[model samples]
Target: MLSYNSLSLYLQVVINLTLLTGLILLVRNGIKTMEVIMLFLSGEFALELTDLVDRLLKLNTLNTYNYALSQFLGLVMLTEIYSRYFLKVPAFVKWIIYGYAMIFLVINIMDIYHRAPVTFYSNIISSIIICSFAAAYCVKILQKGKVEKSLFIVNTFVFLFFLLNA
Candidate 1:
């Protein structure tokens, strides 16, 4: 019988593969904003794939720093994705977003390497920012009052995922 972790890992693999297939189909539709999201998902898939291998080989330490890297990269790409696709942030806002991302990455790395106690700050900040952006997107669509059914479903799923995770 497979353990819970094994089941979860297999489930994640299936989800990632589905995402990859969806991305491929979306690429053919020529939605340029999805390119960043596609890249992020691809990176996420690679990380999870390596994690599956690590579990099989008992090489846990091989992914010690990878979680932090993936989180930071996700934050960075989500910022770009939201700014470009959902909201048109001003230039200065973009600068601040990038600056915060850099600081978040640096603090995350330092905390990991130095065993600093302030590591959670980066995680909290990133979560809050991303959640806020997701909320803003939801609000914007709601105000429009004519969102397509497919978009509404997708938006709800994305918002709920971040909200629950955050």
Candidate 2:
């Protein structure tokens, strides 16, 4: 019989694989925005798979590396998706987001080398930034007086959940 932790890991693998399949299908048939979102989901799936492998192999420190890489890439992808799809922000704002993402990526890379422990700081920073982006998107949609109710509601709740879970 599988232990609880092993069962959880197996469940996560299954969920991520399902999400990966849906994302792949959406990317094949959807718009440009779907491409960015697909990349984000793909990264997530890859990291989860890495986690499963690490668990099965009893690897040393692979989770830290996988997590750091995922956080950085997730932030970059989220910035792109939010700026392009969720917000009607100016180009300068998008550039600023990209700049921040680049800086965060560098910090994470440094953390991967210098920090012996897991990069919780980088994860927290990325989570907060993503949550802020979702909040800002909601505010923008409200201000614009024509809300894409589904997008606004779904993304807002998702990011809030991300923040709390983070």
Candidate 3:
């Protein structure tokens, strides 16, 4: 029987592999959003691999920092993707997103500087922001009355992923 840590490591490896495969496929297809998505996936894949190595090396401090960085980048990348998904993203809304990301980054940096444990509040906030983006995308699709199967599928998964995380 696998220990809990071993099982978790295996799962992480599997997820990393899946993300890599998706990145490759997205690149080959030359989708309009390919660059943003590929960047997101690549960054996440690198961070996750770093996390795995940190864990194996028993570097708890580095793992915590990695997690914080991953959450911050994920927030930015997902926001960018959602902003581009809409034909008309409001200027004020974009400013709000930018402000929120800045605040989050500041909080993380402060925590790291003080050698404080990172807080879950940032994760919760990030999840809420992403879920809202997903909801807006859904509303946009409804208003357009034309569903692109691929987008719908991606939107559904994103919403579910964030919802569960929240």
Number of the top-ranking candidate, with TM-score as the measure? 3
The deviation in Å at residue 150 for candidate 1 is: 5.4
Candidates 1 and 2 compared by TM-score, better number: 1
Model 3 Cα lDDT, one tens digit per residue, 1-166: 9997898688767656766666676666677655777788789879988988988898978887787788778888887777776435677976887778778777876677554444567778788888888888888888989987656765675676567545
Model 2: how far residue 166 lies from native, Å = 1.2
Error of 3 at 7 (Å): 7.8
Q: Rank the candidates by TM-score, best first.
A: 3, 1, 2
TM-score of each: 0.70, 0.67, 0.76
Candidate ranking (lDDT, best to worst)? 3, 2, 1
Please list the residue runs of candidate 2 whose C-alpha ends up more than 4 Å from where it truly belongs after superposition.
1-33, 89-118, 157-161
Candidate 2 C-alpha lDDT tens digits along 54-105: 8678773787567567766777777777777787667886677677667766
Q: Which ten residues in a row have the lowest lDDT in candidate 1?
A: 149-158
Candidate 1 structure lDDT = 0.65
Angstrom error at residue 140, model 3? 2.1
List clash counts for every candidate, in order: 0, 0, 0
